[model samples]
Target: MKDDVDTIALVVVLVLFAAVTVLGFKAARWSRGSSLASLDEWGLGGRRFGTWVTWFLLGGDLYTAYTFIAVPAVLFASGAQGFFAVPYTIIVYPLVFLFLPRLWSVSHRRGYVTPADFVRGRFGSRALALAIALTGILATMPYIALQLVGIQAVFEVMGLGGSSNILVADAPLFLAFAILAAYTYSSGLRAPALIAFVKDALIYLVIAVAIIYIPTKLGGWTGIFDAAEKKLTALDGAAGNPADFSFAGVGQAWPYATLALGSAMALFMYPHAITAVLSSKNRSVPRRNAAILPAYSFLLALLALLGFMAIAVGVNPVGLNGKPNAQLSIPLLFETMFPSWFAGVAFAAVAIGALVPAAIMSIAAANLWSRNVYKAFLRPGASHADEAKQSKVVSLLVKFGALLFVLGLDKSYAINLQLLGGIWILQTFPAIVFGLYTRWFHRWALFAGWAVGMIYGTWTAYNIPNPASGAQHFGGSTAAIPLLGEKGYVAFTAWVLNVVVTVVLTLVFRAFKVAEGHDETSPDDYHADAGEPGVRDVATPGAAGKAGAAAEA
Candidate 1:
C-alpha cells in the first residue's frame, strides 16, 4: 500500500477505520442477546433491535459503500441512467411497508432465521429452500466483492494501491478484511449494527457538506449540471477502457423506468436486506423504518448529483491501473475540492460505508448456509450452538471467497456480476414474495419459474456486449424487450417471464391434480406480533417446524 496524497487524508481514514474496529468488537455486548451461541443471537441480534437502532442499521445496511461509489460513478461516466437508483429506493419503501411487516410477523412467530428458512416452512419443500439458499449465496458474493471494490477505490485515490505486485498492492485491503472478519466473527450482525450509527452520521455530514460546499466551489448547481451534460455530450469511446459506459439515448425511457422498478422489487429480495429486516424486534420496526429509509434515497440523490459536481470542478481520477476509473471520481473530488482534513473524513465515510454493508451481507450469506445448507441437508440434527458455530465459520469462508473475486477477477467483471446478481435474486421473488401471502403457487412451479428466470436472465445479460467498450458478454443490464421491442432491463423481462411461466404451470398443475407441498404457516401467523404466545426467539433448521407445530397444537 502506498500513500500518494497528503498523509493526513490517509491517516484520517485509518483512524476512523480503527475506531469502528473497536466499536465492532464491543457490539456483541451492546444488545446482550441471550446467547451468542445461537444463530438468533449471533446472526439476527436476537431479533431485539428497537425502532431507532433498526432504522440506523437498515439505513447503514441498505445505503451501502457501493451505493456511494457506483451511483455517482455511473452519473460521472454515463448520464441520467445512474439516477435509476433514486427512484428505486423510493419505490421500495412502500412495497416494504406493505409486505415486510407480514414477513416479520411470520418470521418471529415461527422463529425463521433466513428467508430460505421461511421458504422451506411456507412451502414444505427442501429442494425449493436449497434453490433459494444457493441463489442468495451466488447473488451476494459479487455484492460483497463490490464492497471490496469500493474500498479499493478509496485506497487508489489515497495513493495506497496501484502496484504491479498483486500482494503488495492489495495488502492494505487484506488487512482491512482481516479486521472486519475478526469483528464480524466475534460480534455477528451487531458489529455492523452498532457501527451503523457512526457510518450514517459520517455519511450525512459528508453528503451535507459536499452538496453545499462542492457546488459553490464549482460555480453552483446550474453550472455543475451544464458542465456534466456538456461533458456527457462529448464522449468518444475509450480505446481499451472496459470501464467506459454508454449514455442512454431517447429510447432509454422504457429501460430507465423498468430498471428502477426491477431494482426496487429486487432490492429487498437480497439476503442482506432480508437479514436487516428480520433483525428488527417486531412488525412495526420494518414498517416504520421503511417510511424513514427513503431519507437515504434523498441522500443518494444528492450523492448522485456529485458526479456532475466532479465534472464541474474537473476532477479526473486515474486508477492504480493507470486508467480513468470513474469509481474514484468522488473520492478524488473530495481530495481536490476540500481541505486535507475534511477530505480525510470523506474518505473514512466511503471506507466505513463499505464495512457496514459488507458485515451484514456476510452474516446474511452465512445464515443462508447454516440454516438451509448445513442444518437442513448436511446435518439435520445440528443444535442451535452448532448452527451458530457453522455460521461463524462460513461467514469467514464467505469473506475469503469474496476476496478471491476481487483478487482473481477484473473489477469491472465484479460490477457486472453485481448487476447480474440483482437479476439472479429477483427470480426468487415469485417464490418468496408471492408465497408470503398466497400458497396457491405450486412449489414445483415456483422452482421451475425461478430456474427459467435465472437461465434466461444470465443468458441475455451474457449476450449484451458492452455498449462503450464492445466487450462480448455480461456487458450491461439493459436489452431489447422481447415483445415490446423497446429497450428495457433484463431483470424485469425475466421477472415477467418468470411470473407468466409460474402462472401457466400453476394452472396446469391444478388441472392435473398435482400435489401441493404442506405449508407450515397459517393466516394468523402472518399478522402475529412480538408479545403473542407463539413468538419465540429464532429457531434452528429442524426446530422452526416443531416450534410452529407446538404453537398450533
Candidate 2:
C-alpha cells in the first residue's frame, strides 16, 4: 500500500479527535445535576436521559470499532462463517425484549447501578454479586483493548503510528483514552450520551459511503461474492488443507447458528450495555431501542459484505515478513480505494467509535467497584460525596488498565480475550437474567452455579486448539469438552449447567427448609425513583412535604 504520513486526510482525523475531546469535557455542563452525590446521578446520568439520547448512547455502546474492522477481517479469513454476526445481532432484540424490561424495572426500583447490585439484592448474597461484578469487569477489559486496536489501525494506515514502538505508537492511544476517562469522570454517563450522536453520525456516513461506493468499484455484490467464493476455495499448496472454506455442510451451519445464539445471549449482559440501558429515563426507551436498533443490523449486513468485497476486488493485506496479516485487510482496502480526505474522515470515525465505548466501559467498571467493592467491603459508611470521589478516581485507573491491555497484549490475543469475555459474561445470565423474573432459586445455589459455570467455561475455552491458526487457548468457542470429549457451545452449555445446578441445589436446600435471606425491596420499589417515598431512605412526609414543596415550586 502507498503510504502518506502528512496527508490532509490524516490531519483532518487528528483535528476531529481534538474537537470530540473538547466536546467530551464540555458535557460536564450540558446536563449538569444539582449534585453528583449518588449512584443514580454518577453511574446512570441520574436515570433521566430521554429517548433520543438513549438511542445514540446505545448505538455507540453496541456498534464498536471491533465490529467495524474485525467482522470483515473474520469474513476475509474464514468466509461465510463470519457472517453469523449479522443474524446474531438480528436475534438479540427479541431476546432482550423477553427480559430487559424486568431488569430495568427491578434495578430502577432498588437504585442498583450494576447487574451485581441486582444479584446481591435479589439473592441476598454479596459473594454472588462479587462474582457477577468481577466477570463483567474482566470481560470488558479485552473489549476496551480491542477498541484501541481499532484506533491503531487508522493511525497505522495513515503512516502516523504502529505497534512497533511502545511509547511512540501508543502515545496517541493513551491521550485519546485519557480524555475519555476525564470527561466520563466529570460528566458521568452524560458525556458519552452526548458524544454518541457525533460518533454514530460519522460511522453511518462512512459505512453508507463505503457500502455504495466500494461495491460499485468492485463490480457489485454478485461479482464480489463469486470472487470471494473462488479465492477462499483455493487452498494453500504449502500448508496441508485441514480447514475447509466451503460454505455448505452441517459442521459449518451448526457452529454458525450456535455461535450466533450464544453471542446474542451474552451481548446485553456486558455491564456497559446494561449501563446504557439503565441510563434511559423510562423502561420503554430500552424496549424501543431493542425494536429499532436492528436498523443498525441492516447496516451491519452491509459492513459484512466488505469482507467478501475485499476478495472480489483482490484487496490482499500487506504481508509482514512474508506472512499475511489478516488485521490489515480492511485498512489496506481503505488506503487503496478512498481519497485521502474521505479516508481520513473514515479513520476519524473508527477512532471515535473506539473512544466512546472505552469511556463508557471504564465508567461502568468503576461503578461496579465503587458500589460493590469499595463501598460494600471497604467503607460501608462512606458518604455519597466519598462514593462519587472514589468512582471518578477508579474510572481513570480502569482506563489505564485497558491501555495496558492494548500495549502488552497481541492484537489477535486481545481479540481472543474478548471472545473469552463473551463466554465468561454469559455465565452471569442464569443468575442475573433469571433472577429478574423469579426468586425461586436459592441465593447460595446461584453463587455455586456461577462458580461451576465460570470454572467449566474457562477450562473448556483454554483447551481449544487450531493448528493452522496456531491458536492454542481461547481460539474459537466450540461444543467439544476437553478430556471428556462431550460436545456443546461453551456459553450456552455452561449456562444450562449453571441453571441445572441452581435449580437442583435450590430444591435440596428448600427440602431442608433453609432460611432464606431478607428482601429489602417492595413491589412498589421497582417503580420508584429519587423522589418517591423510601426510594433511598429519604422521607418526604405528607402535609409539611406537600406545603413546603408547593411553596418552593
Candidate 3:
C-alpha cells in the first residue's frame, strides 16, 4: 500500500509549476493596459480580450481542475450517473447562448463589474443586489476549495502528501497556493488568462495521450468496457441502493435528467462564469466561445471514460490520510499506467488546472465584495482606485479562506459542501437570468423567492444521508420532491418553488400597490454592442479619468 515518490515525475511537475509561477508574475504586463489601478484593468482585464484569449480564459476558468478530477471520480464510483456531467456541459452552452449576449451587452454598456452591479442597475434595490452578491461569494468559496482538493489529489498520488506530520505533508500544497496568491495579487485576472494558455495546452496534451495510449494498454476500448462492466455489475442492486453498471434504474431518470438541467441552468449563474463573459471585448466573443466551448465537452466525454478505465486497471487510491479517495482515481490511473515522466505531466495538468480557476473564482468573489458590499455599504464615495485596492486585499483573503476549507474540513464533507453550493447559487436564477429578459417580477418578490429557495435547498441538501459515507446529513444533491412522487435535483425543485413564489408575490404586491424599484437600464441597453456610442465612450481612457474625478469631486 505504500506508494513511492517518482523522482523524475516530481521534478517534471516542479519545473512546470515554476514556469507557470514566473508567467503569472509577468502577466501583470501581458496586456499592457494604461494602468492596473482600476477594477477594469485588475479585475476584468480591461474588458478588451480578443476571441482566442476569451476562449482559453473562459475554458480554463470554467472546466477547472475540480471538473477534471470529480467527473471521472464520480464515474468511477457510480457508473452512468456520473456521465450527467457530459450532458450538463453540452446543454450549458446553448443555454448561455440564449441570454449571455444580452448580459454582456448591458454590462459593457454600464461598466458593471459584477452581476450584482447589473442587478442593482436593473432593479435599483440595494437589498436585492446585496442578496445576489452574497449568494455569489458564498457559493464561490466552496468552489475555490474544491479546486484545492483537485490539487491535493495530485499531491497525494505523487507521494507528496504521505507525511505523518500535518505541517510536513501540507507544506508543498501551501507553497503552491502561496505562489498562486502572490501572482494573483500582482496581476489579477490577467494572471489566470495568460497562464490559462499554458495550462490548457498541457491539459489537451495529457488528455489526448490518456485516451489514445491508455486504452491500447488496457486491451482497447472494448476490453476496457467489458472489464468495467464485469466489475461494476457484480455490485449492482445492493440493498437500498440504485442499480449500478446500467444507464439508470427505474425511477432514476428524474434525478438524472433534472440534475443535468439544473446544473446547466446554474452553470452560467456563477459569478466567475459571468466574469469570464463580461471580460470579453464584444458580445460576439461570448457568442462565438459558446459555439466552440463544446469542444471541451467532447474532451470531457473522453475523460469520463477514464473512470471505467480505472476499474479495468484495478486502481484503488488511498488519500494521504489513508482514507479511501475516489478523487484520486484518474491521478492514480496515470501513475499506474504511464511512465514516470508522462505521469508527471498528467499530475501537473491537474495541479495547474486548480490554480487557474482558483485565481478567477477569488477575483470574482473579491469583485462582489468590493462593488456590492464595500462600495455600496461602507464606502459609497470610494474612487475606482480605492475599489481596486480593496479588491486586491479581499482577493488574498478569499484565497486563504479556501485554504482553510482544505485544511479544516474533511475531503468528503468539502465535496458535499460544493454540491450544496450549486444548490445555493441556483436560487439566484430568478433574479439574474429572468431579469435579463423582463422586469415583470417585483423586486421584493424576487428577494422573497430567493430567501425561500435558499432555505429549502439548504435544508434538503443537509438532510439527505449518504449510506456509503455513513453520514447522517449533507450527503448528496438529489432529493425527493414533496407530493411529486419522484426524486430530482434539489436545486431545480427549489427553482420551481422560487418561480412560483415570485409569481404569487408579484401579483400580491401589485394588488397592494407596493413601490417597485426604478430600473436604471433602458430597453436599448440589452441589445447594445461594442459599436454603440455608450460602449465606445466607456472604452475611452479619458472617460474613465473623468468618472474618477467626478466621484472624488
Predicted candidate 2 versus true structure: per-residue lDDT over 1-553, tens digit per residue: 4444847777889889888878887766555456666666677776666667777888898888767777877788777777888999999999998787777777777778899999888878888888998898888887887887787766766765544655776666766777777788887776787788899999899888988898788777788888877777674223443345445333566567667898899999999999999877666777888888998899888777777877776766653223355666776677677988888888888889888988888888888888888888899998877888888998888777777767664454234546667888998998888877777889888888888888988888878765545766566677664455555468777777788898899999999989768666556655554444544421222324332232122
Per-prediction TM-score to the true structure, in the order listed: 0.93, 0.90, 0.95
For model 3, the run of ten residues with the poorest summed lDDT? 544-553
What's model 2's overall lDDT? Answer: 0.76
Worst 10 residues of 1 by lDDT: 236-245
lDDT of 1 by residue, 1-553 (tens): 2246568888889899999999999877665534689888899886777788888888888888657888888888777788888999999999989899999999888889899989999999999999999999988887888888888888888887667898988987898889889999999998898899899999999999998887777778889888876777666233321222345555677978998999999999999999998888778888888888888888999998887888887887667776556778888888888888899999999999998999999999999999999999999999999999999999999889889867754454334546777999999998889999899999999998999999999899888886454467777888898879998889899999999999999999989999888899999999999888898755333323432232222
Question: Mind sharing the TM-score for model 1?
Answer: 0.93
- Model 3 backbone overlap count: 0
User: Worst 10-residue stretch by lDDT in candidate 2?
Assistant: 538-547
Q: Candidate 2, which segments miss by more than 4 Å at Cα? A: 1-6, 236-250, 319-323, 413-415, 466-471, 479-488, 524-553
Misplaced by over 4 Å in model 1 are 1-5, 236-249, 412-417, 467-470, 537-553
Give the per-residue lDDT digits (tens) of candidate 3, residues 1-553. Answer: 3467779889999999999999999888665456788888889887877688888998999888657888788777777777888899999999999899999989988889999999999988999999999999988887888888888888878888788898888887788778888999999898998899999999999999999999889899999888877766766755445445355766779888998899899889988999988888888988999999999899889888888999899998677677787888888899999999999999999999989989999999999999999999999999999999998999989888888767765565344556667898999998999999999999999999999999999889878887766767767888988789799999999999999999999999999989999998988889999877887433434334533332212
Q: Rank the candidates by lDDT, best first.
A: 3, 1, 2
Better of 1 and 2 by TM-score: 1
TM-score ranking, best first: 3, 1, 2
Best by lDDT: 3
